[model samples]
Target: MRFMFKTDYEDDIKLFPHSGYLWSYGSLLLVLMIAPFVLSSYLMSQLVFVCIYATVGVGLMILTGFTGQASLGHAAFLAIGAYTTAYLQQFGVPFIVYFLAAGVLTGIIGAMVGFPALRLQGIYLVIATISFAFIVEEILARWESVTHGNEGMRVKTIQILGTAVPRDSPAFYYLCLGVLILTIIGSLNLLRSPTGRAFVAIRDSETAARSMGINVSLYKVKSFAISAAIAGFAGCLFAHKLSFISPEMFTLQLSIEFIIVIIIGGAFSLHGAVLGAIFVVMVDPFLTFLKDDIPGVIGGLAATLGAGAQKASHIQDSVAAFASANGLKGAIYGIIIILFVLFEPLGLYGRWLKIKLFFQLFPLYKRATFKRQKIYVKSERNR
Candidate 1:
């Protein structure tokens, strides 16, 4: 393992951190830059989705991860953004202008949501956000004149400057990839700023943060707006990807999926957002493989064990039916969340850190270094 000894405080704050970082990130960037050509069309489309979801994850990460706020209504902000873009595009607006409008409009609404959040925390905040989402959904459904009710509104082709970018085109993928990169960069900078520190301070202890002269309420509101704006920007892309906008698309399930993205990815780290996005998107194919292969494998085992061919065939049919059912996907997603929460709470990023440290400290690595510290709450009388 190689180490970079820092010479000064400035060295610690450098964007690259060390030469190693520059090389690693530079190589990753090179890979992404050529991915459209090197990867298949379906894979490129999934990468675009990963980029979009990662941006949304970063937005949610800002609130839940950094600011310590609970939100179950981000899907509302996403809907606002998509509808804003869709509605504006109808008037022949430029992509740059409408994109900004989606973010700005969603930001303003997010601030409104934040106002109510100041008086709430924990589960209450979660419930409030859920209510907010429901309210937004009901309004979208009832406002038939504008939202087209349940019939859904079609999103036009993305036009940057005068060039039309179809969802399937490489240009569209680049557009999303570029947006994700900008979101990550901006988030990193924000976390390094005083305002970002104030967010963390509020998250740790609002009373102590207030005593330290930080405007707790203002920063919480700011965090909400920032997170919402990012989600809104992601929604703009989500709209084009579907080429259709409907209230049903941005449901509570979508909001929960966003939360899952950050959680299973590593809720506390910026890198977790991307990792989680990749996991959430890629897991579908993995599940699809399992759906196809599990039954055959089990049946083959039964046949080898001297079971009749009819019995093996029956077992295979039953397993295949169970695996291929529509509800099975949601069940599997739930199971994954439970497993991750119980066994690997620190998430994919946390797992990667352990692997990295194992190599970095080969022959000296201890499992206890990453073990969760068990704490028991003591009664006041015992204390």
Candidate 2:
């Protein structure tokens, strides 16, 4: 275990609090840089998705994690970015310019949503955001002239510096990784700034923040704008990565997955976003494997239970069909979210922190060190 005693105020806010962090982070970066060369093509593709999802996860982390606000419609911002990029690419606008433009447009839209949010809180805010998402989806589907409606739009290869970059190229992977790295750095810096502090203040206690002379409403709006902008940027990358876009791609299920990403990874930490993204991407194959094997397992069990071979086979086929359906993925996501909320409220990062601390302290570690504490208020007790 390494120990460092703070010698000055600056140490409190230092990005790397100790040399140990620098070494660990540097090593991780080195591994990621070489992964493309070593990993299979399928794994490389997964990593690309990890980067894209991490970008969106970080954006949600800013709004829901840092700012104590909830949005169920963030996928709408992603759709906006994706569609904007798709439209602009057809008109010969450079990727860089239109990519940033998507973020700007989505940020403006987020600010508009945030205005009504100033008067709402908790579940009300959540409902409003959900409504906003549905509205955006409707517009996208109805605006057939621009969005091509439900038929979807095909995206051309991204042009960077006058060279066409295919989505599957290593260069494209690096582009995503680069953007994700920049976003992580930017989020870390934002957290270290006064605005980030204000966000936390609002999250913890808006009344206390207001008493401290912070403009609670304004900062809330700012957080929404920043979060939406990041999501939009991620969406732009996602559009080019897939080379196809449609209204169905950005649905309520996608928004819920974003929320699940932060919840399972560690909603309050920047590292949680990346970790959650990796978890989501990496676990998908296992889920797919399970989906494929489940029918065989069911068939064998049914046969052993004295069912006729023909009946067992039919049952197995039906079960397999249902398991292979698109709803299975959504069901899995729902179960994960529920399980994480009920049992691991602090998320995977929180669990990792406990393990790290346990190792660092060794025999001195106590179970109660990480236990959740319950507060009982006299007023609520009486009620």
Candidate 3:
């Protein structure tokens, strides 16, 4: 009945918790079962967008979250994927070939970049990657023959095995959901394997990992390649979903957004990717709608209160007006990131884990300390 997974530790030095296995799988299954019924077409389409974004976010999580590499050029890899799909489709290639090719091509490019770039770390690495992102974008935008340049390209309705699936159709939503599920499950499985541990080891300390005989370079490149492949897979799906292709679709802003999703969700936790995607995409629209709709009702109430309420109405109007301007979205995201880093660096999933632990411990919660020692509980006890 417990909701959180317990981590093991040796003495005082703590390690990451491995709790929430059942809840993770169960929650996703429930969402998949009910999402079609609960979400309207507009919302469903938005959810598709979240899924695509989460796919890239998951990739970044593996690199940034697990391997401790910061990459601001993830969307560049996505662009590679999107353009690859678009170009291959133009040649009458089947959807399957295009999808696989996008992932493989990006993975190869990522590995090549990772080898040289791993020589740098921290801000320098970030700067290098950011430069790479802009470079990829410029190449895609200026290389007219291959990319069609800024003119962009339009993708036809995606047909699989000669069966066409329209963008807005429920079928397309289901397709996205299926991809999301597969990626999540695959990520979870990978994280449970030796490879995932190696990535985590490298993240914690490359020197230590090397001392422990964990092939640091191989894992580092592997992490980037894998992350790029996942991002590419997302792009393939995205090209079909949008039914159009452009460099604008893969902006630097989006690359930052992907990093935000992982940080807000919980770095290194796949579930964080899901939660962050749902939170960021869903919350923004709801906040926008509330800002637009609530003022009218508030204004009506202000009229009843007469002249004294005039001041209140003005204040409310100003606030509402500001919220509707779209600038607030960035402001809110900034605040969220600030608060999470300061108060919950592990992200929302970290907060969720704490909450679950609180309920699990009940009256004993008051004595519970947020320390490394708690991670050492028996696995049998957790189960």
Best by lDDT: 1
Over the full model, what C-alpha lDDT does candidate 1 score relative to the true structure?
0.91
Give the worst 10-residue stretch by lDDT in candidate 3.
Answer: 9-18
Looking at candidate 2, what is the lDDT of residue 194?
98
lDDT of 3 at 153: 86
Go through the candidates in order and give the C-alpha RMSD of each one to the true structure. 2.6, 2.7, 6.3
The 0-to-1 C-alpha lDDT of every candidate, in the order given, reads 0.91, 0.90, 0.83
Tens-place lDDT per residue, model 2, 1-383, is 87679888899999999888889999999999999799998988899999999999999999999999999998999999999999988889998899999999999989989999999998999999999999999999999999999999999999888898888888889999999999999999999999999999888777778879999989999999999999999999999988999998999988988888899999999889988998888767977787789889999999999998999999999988887887778788878888988887788998899899999999999978977576444433442
Q: Give the TM-score (vs. native) of candidate 3.
A: 0.86
Q: Which pairs of residues collide in model 2? A: none
lDDT of 3: 0.83
Model 1: how far residue 35 lies from native, Å: 1.0
Considering summed lDDT, which 10 consecutive residues are worst modelled in model 1? 374-383
Clash list (residue pairs), candidate 1? none
Judged by TM-score relative to the true structure, which candidate is superior, 2 or 3?
Answer: 2
Q: How many residue pairs clash in each candidate?
A: 0, 0, 3
Candidate 3: misplaced stretches above 4 Å? 1-31, 308-317, 324-326, 366-369, 372-383
Of the two candidates 2 and 3, the one with more favorable lDDT, higher being better, is 2
Better of 1 and 2 by lDDT: 1
lDDT of 3 at 329: 70
Order the candidates by TM-score, highest first: 1, 2, 3
